[model samples]
Target chain A: MPAETTRAANRERLAARRAAEAAARAQAERRRRTVLGGVVAAVAVLVALVAVIVVQTHRTSTSANAAVPANTVDGTVISVGSADAPVTVDLYEDFQCPNCKAFEDASGRTVAQLVADGTVQAHYHGMAFLDTSANGRYSTRALNAAAVVVATAGPGAFQAFHDLLFANQPVEGGSGLTDAQLVQYATQAGAAGSSVEHDIRNLTYGDWVKTATDQASKDGVTATPTVFVDGHKLADLSSAGLTSAVTAAAAG
Target chain B: MRWNAATAGPWLGTAARLVLGGVFVVAGALKVPDPGAAVRAVRAYRLLPESLVAPVAFGLPVIEIAVGLALLLGVFVRTASIAAAVLLVVFLVGVGSAWARGLRIDCGCFGNGGEVTAGETAYPLEVLRDAALVVVALLLARWPASRLALGGRSVAGTTDRKEYSRAR
Candidate 1:
């Protein structure tokens, strides 16, 4: 009888030990899960906060101290050609982008003809996202210079300067045209003035260039030489293609 | 120490941790400075709804950096690995979808990803790279013990025995 009682007591002790071990294991598991949950929660909060700050700062910086050129409609678009033309053409281009130059070369004459005939009103949006490619923020400098020409000398000088800049676009990853060269180009384009000279040299419109590029991106114009006819994106960017698209839009 | 499984397991984890963590950090850093380009890259995929594009583009880089730092510092290795694996799987799907759709777009894995010329897309390579990273991430999740971890106990020592056994 005594032996049996001892055996029963030993079994009870063993069961109690096992129960305590299970409880401890459960507690550890819970703590681990809590820590893991905490990690995820912390990451989510950090991401949200940082993303908001980034987007907010970008917006404020773009608009702060930004200069607006004359004949500009949407802060980014510089309108040229007839105000009441039958067709509206939006040309999104980057000063340092080789592709924009190629596009301009291929279709510049056709666009000029349309403008001359009062058939189309052209809106140019100069972008500066290629600042990294140019050695000295050339994309922004060139864009800012063009803006200065437009602001001081009018859209006519701006058009001439635009053509000249594309005509002599620097190679990618090189320092873009010098400030003196930009002033000379402005003069040749009939944009010569002390104000034009000073603005071009100092990048008075640099903030505007950044704002314009950001706006272009917001408007879904990420790539250079993106064309739109009467709010419709032109799939074929060739001269012939553009002519036909413009004619069709005018007719429609 | 002689080269053996016991000696190598933690070191191997450390190496994987650094390589994968470094990749995440660099990719995130490149994209962070250019949200417009990032948004454009996401748009090029044409998979997400218009409403979700901005949010995803803006948030993804930050997530990558956070997870990368966690892995790099060896803090919360298991949880961070799971997060990394999730991100890799998402990338795999995105690249795979773009490939299937015949869209000529860069995977935008690093930065400046947008519409490329028809000849510029490297969909297969992108998918392969993401798949491999996914494997590494999952492996890290399975065995979070690494030589340079910052938990209460040194993972490379006997302290991680319980975790290793539990993982097994």
Candidate 2:
């Protein structure tokens, strides 16, 4: 009887130990799954946050680009000097570019003096690379419209519009000149009638602006204020360099 | 978990090792030439914050080289395979995000800056490719093509042959 009892006790002890081990393993597995689920949830939240940030940044960039005013210019292309001039200088520039404005402020007067004296013919074509986001309020549209006004209303309007654009080059990526502001500039430049208003609403000069940009690209111009004198490239568009190039081109 | 040379098929294991090794070597080589460009490319994705960009850009190539070498040499084959699989998963996620956003930028994977349309660059295809690699990596991790490896031989010699033979 005692032997049978001892055998039964041993069997019971083995069964209990097995049951305890199984429960321990089950608890461990549950803990592991919980930890893994928490980790996955955390990672998912992190990924979502990153996605939101990226989208917001892209949205801001696009909206900012879209906010700049459109152009409102009119006119026919005109030669800046007499046809008998020795050198022809073509300057492709964006008004919003500081460098372009600087080139104009520094070398513009000298070029004008030369042109007035019949030593050179300066043909200016305004390009619009910085029209997207660089010029906060003034876009390619506004610049192109201004070009049309200069073409129609004459050199006085072009020069006035040019000075105004340079003076109003917004702090990088900010809203550029509004449509109303552009009309004010045109009025100041002696542009008459509803021409500026008409061009702004109709986007009349968009094709011309695109063609000018394409021409600039074909000419191997990448940056702003690219000055080409009689098909010869100058290293810098500064007064000294431009004057020297024009003098050389005139002599050649 | 006794391992033996006889348990893993030599031909299959060697092929997997060569393929995985070639992939890493090619990827690493493509990125090694212009580290700065690679950094810029990653930044353009705008996935990683500015803070994490430098570290990831600098360390990624080195890790890829190490993983490639380890896979080719068959040293730490299992660990290397796991690491490669994890990297592929991360890459898939990034590519998937760009595709979802309708971005028309290059994958910049090989660092050539070749742009592709969002429609052309599908997230599922990238995920499928990575998944295929993951399968191969899992196989390598499980079977461990160690017959030709120095570590494999040492491990096989020390382990009980009878137990592994039965398990295989």
Candidate 3:
């Protein structure tokens, strides 16, 4: 073959190889994009999810802080009856616990009777440890409102309000009673007013509730409605048993 | 990816995704409604820095939900699988630590975790469950070319071309 023919053949073969290489490169780029696009999308979504969670968590905590006044340092162990009563009846309870409500129903009146009779000085340690067991911070809100009533209206109003709370205890896994309902209950117990309503709504004693709950846990009171009579934890946890134990402690 | 596809690729991945994704979705959703409980549950573990507890409690559920949704949709199977594996590992550590420390508490994977009266802690079962999840996650991550994946394609062609280039 002539030199010209050989050169033409070489050019065609080189051009064909270059076209094949370009096609392969384009295909590779498309594949890489496809693979990477999914990962990038996932990362972006995950980042967005985290941002939302952070914002929400911040809102709840900040609102909690806002609810408690800076001046009020801590929630207290609200007590009732004569301070010099022979026996001390300590009750650890939560507003949101159904079992606590049951305990209150079974033995609350008896304890109240004891408190009224001046046989023992009853100390109620209401905690918000069950805050997560329900929706919308029901435990904290209820306990906080109870604290306000106890603080302002004294133990008599607290007993009335406490009974009303259990009487209308909302179901678990719900937003539970709203602020308005809480204020209404407080009012019925003769503890409601503008500032008092504000206290209930803002969760004025929320921090105290938290502190008290922490203290309870540290004190080894895990579950709700833990009754202690003269420093002894009631093991039976029954209404009759609780009353009888209190009576025994008082007698001694 | 293609090699795995030829076997039980998408089917296996889908099954794993469904089981893991379903459980995580339920677990996370149940907690989302009540962040406080989630925090308490984290506190019960007695692991993690105090400052980190709330963030983890809040973020873990969101992460679980996101990964679970991604897996259920089959959109980014590999990434979701990796996330699932990471989540399971963290859970295993928490459950293991709680067991080692003799903390009688619920694992808090779903709702109603944290402190219990007595005889309610189920650490070994929780750990075993998480271990199984980790295995499934790793398997799916290793072979993410499952059936009906959103953007799944065989990587065999790419693998072959590298060999072809090396030969050249």
Instruction: Residues B65-113, candidate 1: write the lDDT tens digits.
Output: 8788878987778888999999999899988887887766788889873
The estimated TM-scores of all candidates read 0.77, 0.44, 0.67
Regions of candidate 2 where Cα sits further than 4 Å from its true position: A1-78, A133-137, B1-168
What DockQ do the predictions score, one after another?
Answer: 0.21, 0.03, 0.28
Please give the RMSD of candidate 1 to the true structure: 5.4
Q: Every model's Cα RMSD, please?
A: 5.4, 16.2, 6.7
Docking quality category of candidate 1 according to DockQ thresholds: incorrect
> What clash pairs does model 3 have?
A132-B37, B10-B146, B10-B147
**Which of 1 and 2 is the better model by DockQ?**
1
Q: Is candidate 1 or candidate 2 better by TM-score?
A: 1
Quality of candidate 3's docking, in CAPRI categories?
acceptable
Worst 10 residues of 2 chain A by lDDT: A67-76
Query: Compared with the true structure, what per-residue lDDT tens digits does model 1 show for residues A54-82?
Result: 67346435555567887677788888899
Q: How do the candidates rank by TM-score, highest first?
A: 1, 3, 2
lDDT value, residue B37 of candidate 2: 40
